[model samples]
Target chain A: MKELLEKIFENIYSNGLSEERYCDIKEFISEKLISEYNDYVMNREIVAKNKVNTLDIVLPNAKVGDYYSQLLKIEDEEIIEYWIEGLKKTGLEVVSEIVLDFQKEDNTMVQGSANLEVFDNDNIECQKQVIGTKNKGLVIKGNPIMSGDFDLTLKYKYKGWFDGCNILERKLRFAINPDPRSLWKDIPTDKNIKFYKDDFVSEYVTVLANDKGLQKDIVAASKRGRSHAHEGKARDDDFKLYHNDENGWYIIAVADGAGSAKYSRKGSEIACETSVEYCKQALQMPTELEETILELSKAEEGYSNRSISTLIYNIIGGAAHKAHRAILDVVKANEDQVRDYATTLLLAICKKFDFGWFVASFWVGDGAMCIYDKERQYIKLLGTPDGGEYAGQTRFLTMPEIFTPESIMSRLKYSIEEDFSALILMTDGVSDPFFETDANLNKVEKWNELWENINKEVDLTDDNSESKNQLLNWLDFWSAGNHDDRTIAILY
Target chain B: MRRLPVYLLIDTSGSMRGEPIESVKVGIESMISTLRQDPYALETVNISIITYDRDVKIIFPLTPLDELQLPDIVTPDSGPTHTGAALEKLCSQVEKEVKLSTPEQKGDWMPLLFIMTDGHPSDIMIYNQVIKKVKQHNFASIIACAAGMKAKVEPLKQLTNEVYSLDTMDSSSFKKFFKWVSDLIEVGNKSIGATDELLLPTPPEEMNRII
Candidate 1:
């Protein structure tokens, strides 16, 4: 530990800080270290305090008032209360009138009068409520504090669900949502935690669900289809969906892992996640300048949308390279299992434009990407799959050739158009069952019929969550004895 | 999405009755168990076993690894090694079972054939006929393993270029051969629908290459 700290200090000193700035450096170091230490300690405390129920609250896997009655048990905890207090400090808007409720084991209510308030500066704004034992709703006195810590105090006695007569006093503390935008910037180095989505989704679910600029609805899902031999093993296909509402951009990446690879599933997962992350970064690039460059370049060339398309193609291509590098990182870290992580990648990025949308897709394997226009009622195939010069062979992203910009550009396909309806990106597992070959992918009737079937089978008009679940279930639709792992990502 | 068909033909003549037979049994079992652990093999490989002593026996037909149960090999007390009968059975089975690709459906991948023996075959003419049939079509790949000293490579060479001569028919050699088989199946499973030829591993250091 000492050696590590000495190395860090040595590196900092090597940055050429003079003795005259010693006081300023000391203050900066103190503030930075204190903040980091606090964050580390606070995160640990929060995990330790609500280890059992934190995942439930953070993920909210269950819905209230559904066919199944959801059980929510808030325990007496210090961090939850302290974190509530921290949120008020961030000065974000918070809804007033926080409520608390107690319920019995068998969905029975316990009637009692309970008071909730935000005691800021000793000003107690008490919102009184009659808490029913069976259930109660507490509306916190403000909109969710976007970023920061906040504290809350709960004084309540509930009859034990198991014991029936013993009264239990509970207090809870919870930190408000942290800045979700950081998730795009901080790529996890740990392999096991790199693909974890609980925290990321909990923080950004609202932003992802927000369809402010999107002209239509988007539905996406993935599933492990039936295995020809093993009943329980997953098919080697994975996908990712990423959307940045503020940036008005969404990315869908799907990878079909090489069945020959022992850890192809891991490769597919890392590929999708890393590619989406890179695309998120690409979305931040100055596109206006790119457009200006394209416009000037277009004057020298023909009237084709080649320049703009090239820009979009390059962005998507660059993201694919980043994903390839991430996979290589995994391979290099564990050379013994180098071939285990081979997989094919397909990435598509779409951003809303004034007329329609600017869309680009890049692929280096056998999968299908289709763009369906609701207005024109036409379906377009983005590009052909890289089926190798053999009957059953295709290239994997792990191959070194795709790492170069030239090769990536050669593989990319793009479009800048109006009347954009929906984008369908899928691994071969799902695509194979639907369309046996790439030649059948662009059949307008088939695409339209598929959408019609989906509309009939799934409730897409009401809730996006329901549609997502339905799509996931739809992936399990078996046909032609083609049992493989299936993954599909849709943007509409 | 097509299944990769794998056929294993083992010689269970009187010569392989002792420790060699037991080793072969253990090896086959271990290979299946290992293949079951791989997600790719479990999902794609459909294996079949054909054992020949005096008479060929189809112990098990093409069955997926998930539902397949490795059967016990019972070699006859005294019988000539009829490898030709086993090859004939395999040829007939492939013709009967392997589906040809059609407009409506994709057929199974080219079959992977592994022929293992401890002695020379009694009926060489039939074996030559089966080899001719296999050569006419694109069988994924074929491997012939000559196990005991009595096993001749010249007879096996007529069947495949990928022929190996095990120095001794001991338990270790049998184990190494089966381990190679398991690894080869895994490679074959991964390459299914993605590559034309089976991507088999190099023979273990103990085994000798037979031209």
Candidate 2:
């Protein structure tokens, strides 16, 4: 049983679906057990009938199948012994029990005992008692002879009234060189164990910052990161980069498609594209509002910062509305659901002001935008996450609030800052690994750690052509075991 | 990374002997097969089954559907409805099984529970205590289904706000109810990390009514 299990685990790690691996194991055990039972029945046909008749003479209508079923029943300790002997024949030493501590409190690998069981062909064990109090991953104990695999079978009793026993099988496969950040904690460093990676890592430049005529190196990059889907999810989160050198303005917009949404990838692509286009159009708006926007921030009267804030608000708010309408248009034409294209939007436009730089940022939902200053060496978060009624629930660009002015004012968040180093925009996929939650978004160390990690992948000190490719590649780094699509855009 | 664990507490006293028991078995199997078809549910949902007769039995521990086998549920020959014992067992299981989040690690999704019964509890006082204990587990959702003519609703109301009474106890009604539960689970799989209670699929008005 041990050798067969080890071989199956190896095959599963090499090239087999976990689902099929389980099915294959089950088939093997059933065949072996049934074949053994068949041999026993065939060998003692006359002796079994004579012994059964002597043991129960009153039994008038009992067939050979009934006798065999009774003998194989879980309630019969002798049948269990036969299974143990079968396991022994397969070179597995059976123990009374073994324990499993899912919460390895001591951070130790080995701890408890486990009970063994055998199914048709899949030899595994059903967990006897789960005593973990916290949410740690698999931990096996009780010195077993097996390496790279463990087997436990459930002992389900079958009555004479029932036809067959109901047994379940479970097998554990640990990764050989597991990532320390893996959610599956404390994986043993066994040579045979290997993390399931169907897709090999590849390098490519999806987008790069195009500095045609700018004051400084405006670094911006976006790439489809590793996700639940290997070759990139059918729908990837998106970012739209806009460089309006004519207007002395640069815009970067990112949209994260909800994993649950069917057409969200398209929605994100459209949202980022539409939002950035609108921001460019907003800059093209008559300079008449600029004087009013400039005046309102200075005035301390009725609505201080209201005029300028409102002007920036209308640009972002109108852009959000356009994105929403665009999604609605797709839904209407396709006869699909608005929720199917649900996505979160984050847009930022930086204008090369005479003083330094005037930046206007807007967002609606999770993810984050930050202002990093090289001189001050500090990171400032633009806004808090608009986590809706639920953790996964967030305000989408397709929400009805995007249409109404009043609701849009309340729902949309806008911020303006000067004397900043760079403008950073990202989807939740990139933000979540560094910042566990929105509340932790302002943690400078977390941001610094991200910066350090990125530097490890790319030389940020030298802002050259290679920096763009390096940033795009760096965006694909695996972190915190989250495989969601990642997108980040920066005007540095 | 964490699975969404769902618990099913079933009552299998003497009264649920023939068609009712068989229908339930078939209904549960159908639910499993249906849930398996959904990609999100297939990746995340883990199910546990516990049955109560004169005593409580954990037919299956929480397990992912990929590795699950549909167990044969048998009706006891003659035993009282030990619903209290079942509730107590559920409370203990919740404590033993539910994972809590730590500073460095995210926890399992809040567990969802379903209690199905056809008769009144033989031990009311004990049932009340266990129900209160179960509530402290802070389950994501708790739904109770009262079936058959003798099944009452008032007791179930105390356990959870999501209580439904089957209009009739038959194979078809059982089938519909199970399908509703399966659909609800599938929808839940899409938003497993939501803080608010999910918008569950409504049960058929003709076959089941809210308490």
lDDT of 1 at A318: 73
In candidate 2, stretches whose alpha carbon ends up further than 4 angstroms from where it belongs are: A1-233, A285-303, A374-377, A388-390, A402-407, A410-421, A461-472, A479-481, B1-3, B10-51, B54-78, B82-211
Which stretches of candidate 1 lie above 4 Å from their native place? Answer: A1-214, A228-235, A289-302, A388-392, A404-406, B7-107, B116-118, B121-149, B153-211
lDDT of 2 by residue, A1-492 (tens): 767876867776776457776778779888999999878655544443333223321101111111211121122322222121122212233332222444343445444533222222223346333211112211222222222111233222111213343321222121111122222222222333221211212222222334533354455555544334432335347777766656566777888877667667678878987888887888875385566645544555465465666786778778888888888898898888888778888887766554345566777767788887766777767666665322354677777865677666665544345566567787777787787655567677777777677668765542455676777777767653355567776666
What's the lDDT for all of these models?
0.65, 0.63
Q: Output per-candidate TM-scores for chain A, rounded to 2 decimals.
A: 0.54, 0.57
Per-candidate DockQ values are 0.06, 0.07
The deviation in Å at residue A335 for candidate 2 is: 2.7
Error of 1 at A207 (Å): 7.5
How close is each model in CA RMSD to the real structure? 28.9, 19.1
Question: Candidate 1: DockQ?
Answer: 0.06
